[model samples]
Target: MSAASERAAAAEGEQLARTLAVLRETSDRPLSFVTAGAFAALDEGGSEPLAADAESGTVIPANGLVLLYGDGGAGKTTLVLDMLVHLASGEPWLELVMPARPLRICLVENEGPRQLFRKKLARKLAKWPRAAETIRVLEEPWQGVSFRDEAQRDEFVEFVTAQKIDLLVAAPIARLGMQGGGTLDEVAEFADLVADVQRRAPGLAAMLVHHPNRAGQVSGAWEGFPDTTMHVQASGHGRTRILWQKLRWSSLLHGKTTHLLWADGESFTVDEREAVTASTMVDEILAAVLESPGASWTKLRPRVRGNETEKAAVRDRLIADGLLVNQTAREGQFRLWHADDPAATRSELRTGLERLPFPTPEREAAAVPVPPFQRSIGTVERERHGRPGSLVADCLICDHPFSVDDGSPAMRCRACVALTADLVTEREADQMRLLERLRVREALRGAA
Candidate 1:
């Protein structure tokens, strides 16, 4: 036989072998596609929650993809390591619970040097030595292989299955050598590949660490790809905010933002003190409007406690929910009022009230005593802040209500006060170290 014919026959045999292998592997599995009604009727048990926080609910689903993306230096890698340690140790990660038994994890480090990765793993293991047993690192040679290729995908599935990995962690999707610049089509194709791999290895979950685009948004069609998508951003003072951007299957954590403090290089803790809830912001807005009826946007906005964006969002939500009325009071000025107030429904200002103005000194002095609404606003603000006069005051830091003497000047609770002092000392120490480093560098330069 000619050499060309022999080569052709060999290629044909290889393709046939691959086809048979797939068939044999899936022979016991059910059909892939089904009608909507049929899928709903399937007796397959509900998916169990893998990693969850008792207070915050499920984070990583038992058998789905989780996308954690952030800008560079936002501690994405560190946070992932923290999560892996918790999963492997069966401990809660930033209060997110893990299964009772340690989960087998496969960390596919594609973005950094193996030696550097080793140092990170070592630091985490120093705290929880036993977790090292369940955590596995993928071989360096296969790190850069693209999952888009069918053969490579099959090999990866085989590796995970052999290791009995329950969770897979892939760092920085860019290093995976996937084609395209994270456009919708490109991301969808990559997502399809992940689904295929998950199908082949049932009960396996994946966490993909990715970098955001120039706009600081997750690049590509990420909205539909992952079961949960978290956006991490630095919130200053060594705090990172993990916003639950998308929760497709569960509403437990929808629109909730959790804050984590970098306690050390190896782990993070949930900083409940700094974490503000949606309800708190809503109360603040309502109180502000009730305090000053027909308060203009400018006057009302600053009273609501939060960043400008959060305040605006909550205020808009109140307007949408019909709890607050935003009406034009005068040219170029809009007024906000409680929806239940009579003034909020008025088309025009009271006819004679604006005209009867400019009272004499005696009349001004005799003006009606402070109205109930006026007093209520002050009381509400004082109560919220836990002012000296209030019997119980909200902690200035965590907003926890604590007992206080009638005239005591204490603003923060005892716990918050101590935490603040420690944080201040830590900052001062860091500054001193920085100064010492600068002095040493200067002395060395002079000597040189």
Candidate 2:
């Protein structure tokens, strides 16, 4: 045979071998055979473990599943957007270094109307001109994505494959028809589906956004299935941070507990000013402590800055860092002394405290709007729900009687309290004045 024919025959044989190998790998086999193969592989020392290849350092692993979760409104969306910026600009994230080459990314969001998402995304990509070129967005609502159905999933999988998507972000798992509970098996099925997506598109990494439960944990067993788990939180004001991180493959991940200020919607930078402020706070705290050694928090409280939150945070950091110590033995005296010098303690603040009291919080959650009935309490009439007059309760101020109903509690009777935020108490000033005048006249008559 000619040399060219021999080469063609060799290529055909190689293709056939590959096809047979794939079939063998996919076919179910006896447990004993699998165990024997595993043992044989273990006995063979020549093979090496797979080398790690990250899409963006360890922040988003290549060809792996990651779940970025937080409470609602915790800036999970912001963090992911920032990540996209890094991918586009080849910029380093808080600690996650970007690869030299730019990655193609897609964000499938379901929480909002597309125009609003477009507006927000436009702001994020303002600085990076190249971002628009590589990032594909789907402002599709969660209800529209029937990922539970195989047909919908396959269509998406095909889209992912066609796009050659390096990183795919599907936010808010709740939106993707995976909203909360079914069974553990159902959760596992969802996880399997996510894995199958990766399998369908080799070298495709996914970052899923999810919300945490009341206990501050992800909703299901799917949490453990992700290759990496990032918990995002809004620390205070515009500041945000990664509350914690769990990385299975590489601890090369950054910012497990670093505060990040949103540079914009699309990016982040370390809250460096916060560090400076904290340092200043520590110095102020130290000076205050030195001025009156063993001074209670109450004593030094007056010296701290206007933001008591910063003050409390700095105090906690001091104690946590071993720069300060609480040495007050008596109750209600939260006195502080130098960690290095217990002997430098000063006298406690108060003469006596009933308990170790913390300052009452001045700030409150935004007040709930009072119902219209409560707003116009005097107008209309209160109807008794009970039989004729089973029992009656009188308004504390007006003495207006209304039948007490078991269905509603005393506190629920907003009409009586008129518990609107703007409500003012009315007093019988005229009656008091007349009584005072009468007493004065009587006294004058007696004296005369």
Candidate 3:
């Protein structure tokens, strides 16, 4: 093939079409196998096992693009930094678990340099309790320019062809061009960019750090594109949780994991998972925790109505998840915990109210007027099947009470929906206040 033909074939814009064709053809079968194989072969320098599940390695193909999106202080950077160090140290993705290969990460971050990255990297590496030098961390901008004009797209395509990256990490896709597109449409365009990247760097897993939409969706090109999509959020008060809203190839889709992250002097390290609860409980826990450096689990547990086992489980889970840490032993009492870690705290602020302790209630499967929008609440409005008032309902987000009656259609109660909305708004406002305080504190410290 001529050099020109070779360049054209390598171009992401062109290759993306071919890749989509292949995807369609193999849609009947699992495409992950091919993607995983491609990833495994692309980088084979290190054979050491890092972290894996019993069934398979923790890292796999179609591990695709792991987008970690959060607000400014959501510890997104810290999490990436920690991962870089942890992977390098050959530490397991989770405690006692091992991966088949050391995670070879390429961070196209807009932050950090050789010194800062290394200093933070060192601290995180030490916390892993594993040997350093097992992983490879590469820091470079995986650039791609976009334009409304086809000529600009083609120019950027040529640039990507020149730099054949295995894993591209882009920060805030909003900052890509000279700024002239609608935000939502830009999001769609961004999603297309991700699709394009996957085509050219077939072996690469592009992880993008982004912000969430106002309606609480993974903002940009969100019309069904991610193989795995997770929302990293903090319980308004202080606990940090990363929930998998969508997972194409894994079972973590509905899975919610709490993460306690702390900076051990430099980069943030995630400790473990915490208890899961209804959205209200999450909001309450965060509210209580953020007010003070710590809150007694004893006093807080009942607010969420967790049993002894559940409370203990949440405590233990928090410690494991790296969202909470042991503050003091007090010689002979049940250990108390605090949001002592920076990563966990930052993550909490990042997610704000999105990850509030909400429960996933069963859908009617084919209910009319989607409850949130429907104005009715009880059987008086909708027929209760001629039976006595025996209807029970709950909020889709917080599992709070909604009423059911025998009249017209289905809906949430005034008090229940109002409470949910109030809680959500309160938590959000509280986060802003907390962030403001943090900002002031930082300014004072910097001035000093």
- lDDT of each model, Cα atoms only? 0.69, 0.60, 0.48
- 1-448: candidate 3 lDDT, tens digit per residue: 9998887566646546655886787787864556776876786532222333344433334326566676666666666565555554545543423434454454444443557756765666666644354343443333443332345445434544455433455565565542334366655655655665555444556666777778666665653655556577765534455666665444533354546555444443455544446444445555555554434566656655445675566555555555554332332122233454341222244421122222223333234445443223222321333443323444455444333333323344333333332333456644544554453343334334
The digit string of per-residue lDDT tens for model 2 on 1-448 reads 9999997688557646754875698786745546766877675421221122233335456677778888777788777887776776555556554444577787788776677778888887787778888888864444377455556667778888898777888877876756348357777756666766677777778888887777877777664677778888878877787754677755555324667876644567876543436778888898887778667788897886536887888887776666776654443345576655645332254222111222111211122232111111122222442222122333344444333333222222223232211122234433433454453343334334
| Local lDDT at 278 for model 3 | 48
Ranking by lDDT: 1, 2, 3
Model 1 over residues 348-400: C-alpha lDDT tens digits? Answer: 34321111122232432344343111101112223444542323444555555
Greater lDDT among 2 and 3 belongs to 2
Residue 225 lDDT (model 2): 74
Report the error of model 2 at residue 204, Å.
1.4
Off-target runs (Cα >4 Å) in candidate 3 are: 1-63, 96-98, 111-166, 177-188, 236-239, 263-302, 305-448
**lDDT value, residue 194 of candidate 3:** 61
Per-candidate TM-score against the hidden true structure: 0.61, 0.54, 0.42
Candidate 3, position 249, lDDT = 48
Once all C-alphas are superposed, what RMSD does model 3 give against the true structure?
Answer: 22.5
Q: How much is 133 displaced in model 2, in angstroms?
A: 2.0
Residue 388 in model 2: shift from native, Å? 74
